[model samples]
Target: MKFFKTSLLLFSTLLILFSCRTEEIQIIDPPIENELAANSTVAKLMKNTVAKDGSKDNIIDKASCLSVKLPVTVTVNSKEITVNDEDGYEEIEDIFDLFDNDVDAIVISYPIEVILSDYTVKTVNSDEELQRLAENCTGENEADDDIECLDFYYPLKASVFNANLELILTITIEDDEQMHKLIEDLEDYSAVTIEFPFKVILNGDTYVYINNMQELEEALEAAKNSCDEDDDNDYNDDDCDKCSTEGIKKIFANCNEWSVEKLYLNEEYLTEEFKMFTFSFRENGSIKIDNNGDISEGIWEITGEGNEMSFSINIPDYPAFNGTWYLHEVKEDSGEVSVHLLLEGNHLRFKSQCSTVKDGLNAILLAEGSIWAVESYKNTGEDETAVFADYQIYFYSENVVKAKKDGAVIEGVWESLNDGSMLALNFSDEPVNAFNKEWEVAVMSETEVVLEANDKRLVIKRIN
Candidate 1:
């Protein structure tokens, strides 16, 4: 009687599990066909990455391997770049292939720096190069789908050059400890990341599948619209309201550091970096204050809502921080955005962060790797390119700049000024051209950077 009861109970449990899992746990449903819209690399990976055996297979493992689609963001140098781009394949190296699925996407953030060396850096930016790197994987271990991988290949390559425009090492110093170890033995500047994204499967119904950015966006749009919604439903008032002033608090709450710029108090101005203050707000309602070498942690909150709000800083040692801060303004233009605060009784109108680490790296990258010639210069309301067009400007390591014209090379120091909105150059002997002073960068792109000063405009370009 005991043996018969145990068998009956086991049979009942198996039937229940099969019925429950038959329900499609789909966040998305691709065409019900064998054809998968994957790149050659992803297709091969998917073909070999078998799904886990559920209760039906009677080989159930006590692990869940499911793939769900969601928005993935990558913040590089304080700029949130929606990672719409995908690179080469990564070697599969899981001892048991954690979930029976191939890695369709990976999000990595690394500290970006340039290594200046004498040898040229050969970076991969194409599909062919990726295949070459895959062939060079070291471990040759047993990976999922019978696909073996031993390493990763990052897409972007950062290199530094010397004044004479010489290739340095491809990799350099890394801030993140894990990334440091990964590339410490290799050559190049390194990027940093603390943790990988972790997720848990809700049930056995979840299984990894092939998907891409376009499909993910479509799913988000569908969720937003709810095309099959009933006409009797009502929308929530809070969902359609204009953005509240309290929203600024959440922006600061992110991990990025905000620099104090454009400080004013009681009609008197002060250094933007006065007191050498740097603010780091955490996502958990905690904030950090760093001045020179002194650092402290405390909690912060915003009390007001809508168009009016006040910032409250709670730190025991810092009594000067006790003040009601007003929302002076919020500005977004030309791909740059920032927040400002005003203390009514105090002479303070403080601007928040606008520059990013990527911005600095971009300026450096563009300034180097090119021999810029003057395409147009309008100073004193005259086209002066005819005269300065012969000048070739070269940016190099250590903020050094060299302008070569008429067999004479004048060396100067170039730096990013005014919250990275301006490029300033101070030469040992200032040139007579219009670009020899502080220039408000009106345009910065991969091909060119436009500068304006005193109602005058300058265009520098790389034609090669």
Candidate 2:
């Protein structure tokens, strides 16, 4: 009695499982909406590529694969096989068949029809309606005669396979033109996954399939109407906290505080540019100062919280002026500075002069044939590298020099006086020192511009 009861229970369990699985695959009547329109090199020769019925048994063995059609709608090896878009396309690859002792040939053709089985999210322009479709996808069912569809969008990843059962192609799609072409040229019996709505190409042909057409059209329409909603403004994504509107506002505020204008300064204006400098603080703890072509320096400082910064420099042959400086003014793109110079023997108080900046290329005061000050060497205290002084000489754009005085900014088209790799400095107008010397560009970088003349190299630290 016990054995009979156990057998009966097992039979009942199997029947229940079978019924549940069958119920899951409901055969619905076929709908008529699923329809769509459609659309290299290498060597060697192989024989015996065709079977008895004149079909390509192995394309690799064919010396020349002929463009043949499905004669009488026959199947191959008892499997539903169809010629891919690559079927008629010839000369695809040339492989060496070692066993056959011949170079295997490859042929290509078009008109591939694939029975796709996977439903993937496709990336298209952001459309809420299509997004809803993607979220509601019921997936694919093989046993069901009827198919269900939705309006969804997501990123798509796709690949292609060859007769050898190896993945031979992979592509990505994000653009409409590319996606449209991809759906038009699929190989028969292939599959596609619409992961993200990007553009993709396969086997040198665009694919067009029935599965992607409706969603694609809907997604495109949604994208067209959803243009006003920018991703940058919607900082609600999990990773978008870093780009919050409040964070951006704070950055702009700092930029507003340290703004500086481009100006020219010289004997006409005894005061330095702006007379004060400013800096902007960023949420990421970084700072930015701006400059135009004339200024050539964009200095910034990144520091720990609540700590002062010590700006350093190496002035040739002279003792450095080390000090604590505070923010004087801030602007969107530039700033001014108030530096307290602390020297070993003297305390120097200086205010930078401000002037509207002119174009550097246009700021040229040419001395092509005119006499000017050339740099002469100077030795200060015990410094090994001797500083130079201003001397009188003539030059073209091909020569370089040095400036000695502290109260001067060279404004002329400077050049390498000697044959060497150096920056060319140009002046705004004909200054006394400019006529007196040929200034050599000492340092050149994105943020720092320095010129060495006389025994001194004037360093312009970009505070703006």
Candidate 3:
């Protein structure tokens, strides 16, 4: 009886040990590349659509070398849609909003018309001949009477991909009153043209036409101006437009259109000299945050119109943080613009907002207190210039100061006191950059200040 009882106890212990010793299941994380495969595929697919149907395909393959003469006004179905404002007044406002929000591209549709002016289609070897032809074709008397220049005509009706992936043809159609008859003629002409060893793709449908390359380029230029960004012109606000026309009529003669101007924070502030926290939008309609400032190229998304602009930015660094920005509230006829930004679940601040005038000029110079930064004087004293990685602080406005050193950030209110003609900075705490460490705003004249906690002696000159 004792032996049997011992055996039963031993058997139970072995069973328990076997159950406890089950193989450990490892939960390995997915590969980074694999995790983003779905999104990457979608982007590639979008590229394919544009490349396949658009001029990019031809550019890549080197098969059909067609250089589109820009600024060529096109008309579709007797509608005038686009114009060229050589001064960039038409596109500046949208451009600024685009940069501020971090948008790359969008699909917009519009009715268009193209006037088939005299042009020469040629190869790279015939560039000079083409130029000569263009020069010869200039002036009304030089235009060929045999070929109707006034009649918009399509040489090729549709584009088809060749075996080498080159665009075989760019579709064109006649801008004429008899488009119905023209379609019927095209159907029969192909039957005869095939015998002559020519194959043409037919443009059977029409919805939207790509804006003339020249016009699109011009628009981008206007946008670049609107953002008030000058890459090579850093530290010189000499030509910078501080304000943007949110929605104002820019008139040139009888032709008038509405445009907006925006301040480009990207260009105004030094990206390399200072660390910037970037926020962007996500595919899931949520804002993504990135602190590293890499992973995706930044894009600004601009929505709404006129004085009211809903701005959003997407940064490759901060994938999770995204939010909407707006102009500050103003009474009608006040002609005041207040820029405001809202990050998800975060308190709103002044740095996020920028104010502008009806003419798209920043209102700061005209404001009671304008927060501006000028060129810095070269430090002669034995001191280290502010180190960005180890320690930094961002003083955006009189009320907000964010200080950071060694990967930690502290935020609080701040103030600047006036001593005679100079301005002195006083923070809520000793800034991470150090208080006694001196800095100067290099204006036209010399101004110096010895900074201390809650007190400073400053000499400054204002240049408008």
Candidate 4:
């Protein structure tokens, strides 16, 4: 009986050892690539997305891979200025514009701090030290490590799991810094699965939905070097990164009564002739032009994609405006929409007067007790602003204008024509008569109204 009991005990121990080995095999069976391993390609791409972008401050430092810390003192064109923030860069630009003939230079004060691409901050005591650091950066507009065309949407939840696929903990990633740290802290025995159906923005305007890790990886790889990073020191060179064909189509189809605000053909301005016409674009690729009760029909189409979009219009009556013009920019400011098109030396801008924008401008113009003073005026390319220095103009809701000077008032009939694109004034008085005619509303705001005619420009500012 003792020998039989020993044999049974040994068999039971072997059974237990076999069970332990099976479980160990299961734990180590998961492939490292399936998890958020430290050396995984996905992890590396995520790190690149979160890496610090020092090119934003290239305007001040003239370095693409480094940024000067804020509140640094610098001499801009012999004028000492303290750059407190990004707005200070514009101030420096203004100083640089003060004189165009002179050489522009910026001298940085010593002992200033700079941030590297990896977000490392270091203090440089002299110009030589800063130059040495800048020498390590990529050349202007050259290829760089950081991916500028793609960005992950924030507040993403990551589901963490152990090697056995058991839920460990969930992490919330808010911004780039949090994401960077999360990817950096990934362990070999753990897996991080980003919750599916997350969004990423491409070129700051296009939205892409990612369903799984594979899609995310593919998107990151595709967008790594898909655009111009704008790493050059020319801050004013606006890249149309956000411009897309679909966006331009939506803007054109949605808004009616688009008037030509500016039109140039081979360096000749032709805006005055098109002032009387209003354009309407249809989604079915049809266009209608209304010229003071006269209607003309045409077909329009947009070709290409993204920033390479081109607009082609064939208006049989107006051949000058017909061309496959490159879409330069589409901008909206304070309810106003403007589309800029360029081809060779030709430039055209279409300003839309949507109902909301027109109503807003009319409200500002007809506001009770509002008075506008002539800030500047030009007649036939000659400055005649001083003639109306004492005049204060008022607009009534009933399309009546009254110019008061020295307690004497001159009545004039006024109208907002071309869907608020033009301001027509019929003042018979001598000084204010110079403002008569259909003036294009080049700019309209709460505090100012700028009108332009053929060789005549007028600027009026609101006083009260």
Candidate 5:
């Protein structure tokens, strides 16, 4: 019958070419390493309970760029909770309106904080934001006023391979909207993908598509050198010489009862029986302050070593139970058994006071179109956080204090001590790296503000 009807049309075109070569484009080699993520999407952003703060609801939005650290704690129903501003501040403001519609999921926690940059190609001289960024770029310019963009800065972190995730950052590139969606590119796809949620794997034929702009700047310099590294380690796979600083001084040198969760003085906050006092720390520095079980008599030291050390104590006559400290960075995947403190310039804060723990601090809504950003300053804490990241400090309700960068806005005169205990910031000609002087307001919020001089401690954060 015509060769059995052409052998049934050649076995149906060889079964549709073997189902199109078994559906090609594979790509998902996820897990990004360091600790196998636990294996992908950073193990759905970390857990074992209480999403460590990337969101178990401290709040997540601003387009899921993410924001956290407010005494965090989760597990809403099976018990175990905490979200402070005084115990579940109205359920953390109704869980920031219940995750404000989860802005397209980008949950980030762990030590994985981010802000790396190499981006700097500015260009676009504004004509209504270059007609909305030239409808997605068609570069090599000729018209579209030489389009360029990709400025930088503003929350975008999570790609921690080789494990160290405990990195704090501040890599502003400028004019952002997450650098206008990583320098868009019309149909010009060349792989940029950092719409962060975590996933990386470059060498063994690393995928996620890339071709030109020099393989999209070598896949953004191999995902910013696998998400930043200069020994600020934490993308995990163990053995960073066992998380160095001589393994965090042999894991905090030993014998530390600590127990004083938090107890600030002028920066106020001495919670529940004033954080049930109990301070012990001896590997020979000799110190003990147990107030409730009475133990007092301190004298400790350890000045500058890895990560620029500083943790002094004296308690003889007590100057707010002796000062000098720095080591508040919690989470190395935080599995408690803690010892956190921060005095130098932040006045005070000590944690490790269990019994159903607690933590919360995020203030500095000092007012008047507030805008601060001098994160860290203990002498030259990174050149006063790079001269206040090019200045921008303003606070007034007639307490006056102003300093903007990029255009004359100088004006400073702030005072606070009448039992508000020291906070003086003056400025006549200003430019004295330390932002004029006087401080002691440890923690403030509306999003962050810590300060302390003479032992230097200055952390200010609130960029608009």
Candidate 6:
């Protein structure tokens, strides 16, 4: 009986000990594949996207893969000048443009520093050193490894986590250099998570929102080689980099008139023939071509976006001017705006005068009781001032023009054209038939108007 009692006590003690023992816990970690690997394709693409674009200073170095540090002195055509920044490149171009017949050359003041494709700065002590470095670069306009079509908006936040999924560091990247360093310093064992909701710019203008890593990788891959990087020695090649279809359309619609400043069709210069033509673009996709008082209708549209945009015009009557022209550059200088278009060997330039100047000229011509008398007149180098010595010309606000001498009156129509750069006079009177021509306004004011046509000149002074 004592043996049985002892056995029961042992069994109960064993049960209690087994029940009090701790459970064996397996600490399974989260999958490492869920984290971004430093050597992944997306990380490599990001590094390439942020790589230094040395082609921006190609004008100075003539090397598309490296750039000379600025504030360097250069002898352009024997004229010494310090190029402080990118704007100083224009100064070098101006020197070269001073004489087209001379051999244009630029000599960089040596011991100048150069930045390479990897963002490494090197000292170039002589022309030989620069040439050696330049020889390592890709040929002009050739393909390079750097991705220029995609750019990330900075101040990007990224969190670095250790192997245990504990946050080791959080960094704010401010620029391309900072982002490049971050990608270069990443370790395979560590994971980095980019904060969501950032912006990326494609081809310099298209903005895209990136919500996650997958979207960012896809965007960067798609943007690769999407457009021309303008990796060339020509500084003016990328002048329209910031141009957009909507912006070009706005420029066309806002301008009152555009005159043909230059026109080349298949290597033939036709600028003179179209000088009197003025173009007006409406928001409804209709275009008007006004040559003096004769008007023609056409359909116009801008297609594509960003720098790849094209301007297409279809004028049934004007076949020579109908084509889908590539929008090259839109330049605004002083008070004039110029839109340059190109197609193969053909080129076209449209210029517009300032609106303020056009308005001032219109106000002077439509003034109340304005009587203009002939001050001088020359027809084909022959003095013809006596032909209208007794005539007094009257300009009406309704575009009616009348010239009265003794008792006879000559009726004519006058209109201000070419953004006030020209005056068109249409007269059926036999006595003043010579005046029925589009006259280029050489000078205009409240008191005097000077007109020129071929070799003929006419000057009229406001007498009232």
TM-scores of all predicted structures: 0.30, 0.17, 0.17, 0.47, 0.23, 0.49
In model 1, which regions exceed 4 Å deviation?
1-277, 280-288, 291-294, 297-351, 357-368, 430-434
Q: 254 in model 1: Cα distance from truth in Å?
A: 14
Over 4 Å off, model 3: 1-116, 120-263, 266-283, 287-464
Candidate 1 lDDT tens digits, 1-464: 01112245643543442222222222322222322222333233322222221111101111112111112233322334443322111011111122235332232333221111111123434435433533432222212232111111122122222222233222221222222232231221112111111111112111111144334223333333322211111112112124354456545542166555545555455644454777776766687888877988877676666545666667666654556666544543333445555565343323354544235434543554677777888877788778776788887767887888889988888877655667887766545333668987655655677677776877888664
What tens-digit string does per-residue lDDT give for candidate 6 at 58-102? 778888788888889999878899999875875576455444378
lDDT of 2 by residue, 1-464 (tens): 01112245643543442222122322232222322222200000000100011112223212111113322122322223333443222112101111124433322222221111121223322234333433332222112211112111213444433333333334443333233334533323133333332332211112222244455444333333332211121111112222333433343432234432322122123224433444343454344333332222223332222223222322222122223332111111112222222222222222222111111211222223333332222223233222324323222443343332455544434553332213345544443333344445443332344455555444333222
Worst 10 residues of 1 by lDDT: 87-96
Which 10 consecutive residues of model 2 have the lowest summed lDDT? 40-49
Clashes of each: 16, 98, 41, 0, 21, 0
Q: lDDT (CA) for every model shown?
A: 0.42, 0.29, 0.28, 0.75, 0.40, 0.75
* Tens-digit per-residue lDDT, 389-414, candidate 3: 34444445344656566667666544
Clashing pairs in 4: none
With candidate 1 superimposed using the best TM-score fit, by how many Å does residue 62's alpha carbon deviate from the native?
47
Greater-lDDT candidate between 1 and 6 = 6
Stretches of candidate 6 off by over 4 Å are: 1-35, 236-464
lDDT of residue 159 for candidate 2: 44
Give the number of the best model, judged by TM-score.
6
lDDT comparing candidate 3 with the true structure = 0.28
Candidate 4 Cα deviation (angstroms), residue 17: 42
